[model samples]
Target: MTASRSSTRSPSVKVAEVSPSAASCLNVLILPLAIFNWYGGTWIRNELEVVVVVVVVVVVVVVVVVVVVVIIIVVMMIITIIIKNHNYAFIINRVPLYSA
Candidate 1:
């Protein structure tokens, strides 16, 4: 027995309608003047000043936390060394050791 094959066709393009009463498409002559005069330079300066303040606050907080952690670690190490060094000789020798 033999089988049959089928073929498909592509779709066509579409067209849009334009009106005569519409204004010209390139009518943006006053856009730059409007934008520059709208907010001026103070807006950008204020934004940058706020960003710098926020960054400085973040850095200060991180440095303080790091210093606190380092101090805690140093205190713990000093305590450990003192305990090890000042222990009685007999007490240390009395501890048992495991061997294989």
Candidate 2:
């Protein structure tokens, strides 16, 4: 198998590829979104918006998954307990005694 160029790129080479002004922000993928608008302002705005949207989506998905898992576990446990105790009764039958 051939080695990938980008994955094999050195740290210094990757650093040199990006401009000094674009070094920060940690939003390298945002550059393509603002390709039409080369000005830094539009890029920064679009980048922030995309990051926020992605983060919110991820958080919502995680919460939904956790809730679903908890519900499933609780349901399973309840079913197991009911089946195990199905033969048992909560009330005992007793005959009334006559008064003297």
Clashes (N, CA, C under 3 Å) per candidate: 0, 0
Per-residue lDDT tens digits for candidate 2, residues 1-100, read 3568656866665443766665554355454546645754454465467777556766998999999999999999999999788854443334335555
* TM-scores of all candidate predictions against the true structure: 0.44, 0.44
lDDT per residue as tens, model 1, 1-100: 1233224333453544645432222124234334655867334355455446556766898999999999999999999999889867788787778664
Model 1 weakest 10-residue run by lDDT: 21-30
Which candidate gets the maximum lDDT versus the true structure? 2
Q: Which ten residues in a row have the lowest lDDT in candidate 2?
A: 87-96
Error in Å for residue 37 of model 1? 26
